[model samples]
Target: MPNDLQRFVFVLFDGFSNMVLASALEPLRAAKGLPNGPAIDWNICTIDGAPVTSSSGLTITPNASLSQISNKADIDYLVVVSGYGVRDHGTAKVRARLQNAAQHARHIIGIDTAAWILGCCDMLRGKAATIHWQELDQFADQFPDIAVSQDRFVQDGKLITSGGASTVMELMLHILTQQFGPAVAFDVSNLFVYDAENQYHLIRGADWLQGSGGDDLRRAVGAMMSRIETPVSLKDIAKQAGCSLRSLDRVFHDNLTMSPGKYYQMLRLGRARDLAQATDLPLSAIALQTGFTSSATLSRAFSKTFDTTIRTIRKSRAIR
Candidate 1:
C-alpha cells in the first residue's frame, strides 16, 4: 500500500471546547484505520508547550509549542481550535503564527469560535464563513468585510469554518471524502459510528428565509423549528401560539405558502440531512432522531420530497 498519511496539525488554545477538539480528531483516527492501516498523521499543539484546559475543565498537553514547529511545508492543514477566550487568545504572536502557517499549509480550518480569530487575522477577509451561533451577531458586527452566515459549515477555497462542536465532524468528513474515495470515507465514518451519508447546509445566505415575514410568522416558524425532531400536532402548535388552528394555518399559508405540517416536515428533513452528512449515524437513527416513524417511512418521504434516496444523499456528501 502506498504511504498516504495526510498530516494534520491542530492548534488548541485556553478554554477550548473539548467536544469540538474530539469531533475534529476522532474522524482522522478512524481514517487512519482504513484498509491499508493508518492513512493520516495528526499532532496537537499550543501557543506555548504548557498544558491547556478546555472550557469543561479537560486538560491536554500539546506535543509541541507553536513557536517550535519547523517547516510548515510538511503539513497538509493547520486547524485552529478556539472557544471562550478567543479575544484574549488572539495575541500578536498567535496571529503571526497563524499568518505564517497559512502561507505554507494547503488549507486553514477554524472550529467553533475560532472563525472569529481567523477573521481578526484577515484570513477571512471577503471570504464567506460561519461561526458558533452565539458569536454570529458580534462577529458580523466586527468583521463587516467577511460574509458570515448561520450554516453548519462553510468552505471557501482553502479556508474552512464550522459553526459548532458537531460541525467539526462534518468539516473533517468533507475533507476526508475529498482526499480519499467516498467509499473509504464511508468506511471510516462507519468505524466512528457516524452517519456516512448526509447533506449539510453550507450556504446560509440571508435569502434562505425570504418568504418568512413579520413577527407572528417568525414566532410560528420558530415554534415549528424547535419541534422538528418531535413534531407536535397542529392543535398543540396553535395552543403554543395562543391562536386557533385555522388562524395559524392561514398565517403559514399566506406567508410561507405551505401547510404547517409540510413546513414542519421540511424542518425535520433539513435536520436529518445535517445529521446524515456529518456523522456515521445509521439511517434508522437519523430517522428516529429527526422524528420519522421508521427508516422505511423516512426513505419514502425523503425520496418523494427531495427526488433522491437517503443513501444516495449520504454517499454524495461523503464523496464531496
Candidate 2:
C-alpha cells in the first residue's frame, strides 16, 4: 500500500506448480519484515477470470484476471509461472495479453516453461535464457536465434528466466540480493531452511553459499522444522546439527539476532499460524500439531507472537 511499493503481476496458467509459485513469492513475503528491504506488492492472475488448478490438484483463485490488469497502473514486475500443459496455454490470445502487460512491466520473469510463453510474446527476443531442463532440447530447436543456457536461472537486461522450483527460489533471492543486499536474501533463505537440502545443485551447479557459517544456522533451523510437533531442547538441537549449544546460541544471535530458544518458539508459532490460516482443523488439533499442550496455551502464545486473535484472523481471511 506504500507509494514506493513495487507492483508484481504473476500470471499463472493451468497445471502450474504451486510450489514454484511459493518458491518465487515467499522470499518477497519474508523480505517485507526486514527493516529496510525492498517494498513490494503483488497480484496473482490467470488468462481468464476463472480458478486454475495446479499440477498437484490444488486450485487457486487469483486476485484478478489478466484482462483486469489495467495498463494505467505501474507494473514493476511480471512473472509468468508455467508448468504442465505450457505449450497449449501460450496461445495467440494469451500472447497478446502478455505483450500488453509487458509494455508497463519494468522486469519480466519466466519460470519453468514460462520462457517459451515469453518467447512467443517476443519478450525474450535476444535474451539468453533457460526453461525446465526437460524441455531444453525442444527450447533450443524452437528458438535457434535465442541463445539458451543450461544454468538454473539467467537474467538478460530486464528479462529473467528460471528452470524449476529450486531455481525459482534462487532467482528470487538473487533479485532480493540485488535490490536490497545479500544480508536480506540470506536472512530470508535461512527462514525457509534452504541449506538443508543437498539436491539444489543438480541443475544450478554449485551454490552461492560461500561457507560463511550459514549452513550451520540452516541445519539448526532444519532440525527445528523437523521437530516442530515435538519441540526439542537447544542442547539436543545443537547436537543434531553437529554444533554445541553455546555455538548454536551464538549462531542464532549473530545471524538471526535472536536466542536459540526464542527462534525455536517463533518457528513453532509460525507453524501454528500457517495451520490456523490454511486449515479448518480446530484449535486443539492445531495446538497438538504445533507442540502446544492445549488450545488455551496455544491461543495465548499465538496472540502474543502475532498480536491478533486466531478467531479474528480467520474471520478476516474468510471476509477477504
Candidate 3:
C-alpha cells in the first residue's frame, strides 16, 4: 500500500441506488479539492468492470473489475454500495471476491442494504452493524450473530455499516476526520453545506435533540456537545446559550422531552459509547475523556443509562 494515497474501491452492484453511491463518493472529491489536500484515490467497481444499471435506470461505468482487485494489496477501503434488490445481485462470486479483497484492505464499509450482502457472506458476524431502518427487523432476523442497531452507523474495528444514503456522508466525514484531522473534515463539510444542516451541532447521530427550535436551544446543545471532555454545569451551559436555567430547561423539555441535565448525560454517554466501540482506549481513558471523574463512575452511569455494562459492549465489538 502506498502511504501517499488513501485508495478506496466502491463495489457497486446492479440496481444500486445512485444517491447512496454519490453520498459515499462525493465527499472524497470535495476533500481533495481543498488546499494542500490529502491524496485520496477512489474507483467505482463492479463484478465484471462493466457499466451497471442503477435502480433509477442510470448506468455507471466501473473503473475496475472484481477479478482485477481481488488480489491487489494497495486498497485502503472496500465499500459496498447497494440498496433496492441487493439480494438479487449479491451473487456467490461477488461474495467470494469481497472475502478475498478483505485480506488486503484496511476497512470494509457497507452502505444502505449492503450490510445484507456482507451478512450473507458471514463477513459481519459478531460485529456491530446496522442497515436502513425499514429493513431493521429483516436484517436482525437474518443476521442473528451480528449485533444489529438502529444507529445511523456502527463502526466495529475495520468494519463500518451505515443505515442509508442519509448517513453515508457523515460516515465519510468521520473517516476523513480520523485520517486527516477535524480541520480538513470540517472544511469539507462546510463546502457541502452539511455543517449548517444540523446547525453546526457536529454531533450528528444523537437524534434525541433534533428539531427546529430557537438559537438559544441550539447553542445549549452545541455547548453540551463541545464540553464533553470537560463538562460545564447547567448554569454555565445556560449562560453560554444566552438563556436562564429555567428557560433552557423549558426549551429542552419542549423539544426533546427531557431536561437539559438528562440531555447532557445522553450526549456524554453517546460519546463514551462511540469511543468504546471505535477505539482501543482503556475504560479509564474513555471515562476521563468523557468528563467522568473515574472509570467506576463511568461504569455505573453507563450501565444505568444503557442498561448494559461497558465490558459487554466492548465484548460484542470483538472482531475475529
TM-score of every model? Answer: 0.59, 0.64, 0.62
- lDDT of residue 182 for candidate 2: 53
lDDT of each: 0.74, 0.80, 0.80
Cα RMSD (angstroms) for every candidate in the order listed: 12.8, 5.9, 15.8
Query: Model 3, 43-159: lDDT tens per residue?
Result: 788877888888899988887796687566567898988888877866788778888878888899999999999998888999999998888998889889999998999999989
lDDT of 3 at 196: 32
Worst 10 residues of 1 by lDDT: 198-207
Question: In terms of TM-score, how similar is model 3 to the real structure?
Answer: 0.62
Q: Which stretches of candidate 1 lie over 4 Å from their true place?
A: 1-3, 70-73, 194-320
> Of 1 and 3, which scores higher on lDDT?
3
Q: Rank the candidates by TM-score, best first.
A: 2, 3, 1
Q: Per-residue lDDT tens digits of candidate 2, residues 18-120?
A: 8899999988898785433468778889878689899999999998888698455968779999999888876888989888888778899999999999888
lDDT of 3: 0.80
